[model samples]
Target: MSEKINVGDKAPDFELIKPDGSTFRLQNQLKETNVVLYFYPKDNTPGCTKQACEFRDQYEVFKEHEAEVVGISADSSDSHDEFERSHRLPFVLLSDTGNKVRNLFGVPRKFGIIPGRVTYVIDKDGIVRYIFNSMTKPLEHVKNALEVLKNIEKK
Candidate 1:
């Protein structure tokens, strides 16, 4: 794993298959609005479910601000589909089956886990404005991202 990106750093671009079977290029898909890219260890687990549901609960607000949420993991698209269905998620769940995006973002991968809980908020310009790593109380992660986006809205 490389160094974790800092604020204002350019976010790495990658292509992942969308749930609808379309290929999604990170930069291209995010050209119109802010992008909330979060990496988790896996889907269908307790911590991961809590974090994803928190985002789902706040998803409408994120959409209202012209932002889209994407959850990534080494899990297959099938697993993601199951998670989204079971949780009624309203956003895209991307598959990083090869761990390419995980490595590109320098998400910590240790302890036999695919990736640690890391969230990055990328603005329309493809710059990372915030990154949060914590599974406990994951709502704080979404709150921080919204704060940044709200501040940007003020600008």
Candidate 2:
């Protein structure tokens, strides 16, 4: 496992496949707006779904703060497409096949099995400002991210 990414660290740039099969590069996104990069375990799962829906519900708020939400998981592009469509998620969902990005960020695995749930609030400058990691309280990820973005906006 790589070193765990921490607040104040520059977020590592990476490319992943979006639901539409287009490329998503983190560095390119940072040039436009702040990013709420969330790593979840799976698609269609209960906790993951609720977390995603909460993000969808607050997506406009994020935009108001000049942040863009992006979700990543080991699921495939087709699964991401279905999840986004079914949940009406306004943000992009990226397919992190083989959990490469997950490991890159050193996101933990629960019980040495389940993939961890983590949210990284990254500023437009590509600096990570906050990180929330919780396997049980999925919805808190959304709340925490919004709080961080609000704080970032105040600065």
Candidate 3:
């Protein structure tokens, strides 16, 4: 794992493949809005499903705060596509097949086995304002991210 970043640290830049086979660059998205970039273990799993659905349901709230919620996983583009479509997720799901972005953010694995479930709240200036790491409380990810974005907007 790479060095863990702090709250005020500049978020590392990365590019990953989206569900449609297009590239998603972090720098470009950060230019317009804050990003709720979440790294999950897999697609269609129970915890991941609940997490994604929570993000989907609260997606409009994120948009109201001028934040973009994005999910990243090592799942392939086809799996991502199916997951998005099946779940009716309103946000973008990136295919981080190489786990490069996960390592870039130093998201640790659970028990040195499963991939970590981490959520990062990054501002438009590319600073990481908050990070929530939890393997069980999946719904809390959406709630915490919204809270952080609201606080950031107040500043």
- Which is the leading candidate under lDDT? 3
TM-score of each: 0.93, 0.97, 0.98
**How many backbone collisions does model 2 have?**
0
* lDDT for each residue of candidate 1 in 1-155, tens digit (9 for 90 to 100): 66778889999889999777999888896778899999888898888898899999999999888899989988888899999999999999999888888888888865756468889999898989899887665677788888888887787
Ranking by TM-score: 3, 2, 1
lDDT: the better of candidates 2 and 3: 3
In Å, residue 51's CA in model 1 sits off its true spot by 1.2
Q: Supply candidate 2's per-residue lDDT for 147.
A: 91
Q: Once model 1 is optimally superposed onto the true structure by TM-score, how far is the C-alpha of residue 119 displaced, in angstroms?
A: 0.6
lDDT of each: 0.86, 0.93, 0.93
The sequence of per-residue lDDT tens digits that candidate 3 reaches over residues 1-155 is 79997799999999987877688999999999999999999999999999999999999999999999999999999999999999999889998888889999999999998999999999999999999999999999999999998999899
Over the stretch 57-90, how does candidate 2's per-residue lDDT look in tens digits? 9889999999999999898899999899998999
Candidate 3 backbone collisions, by pair = none
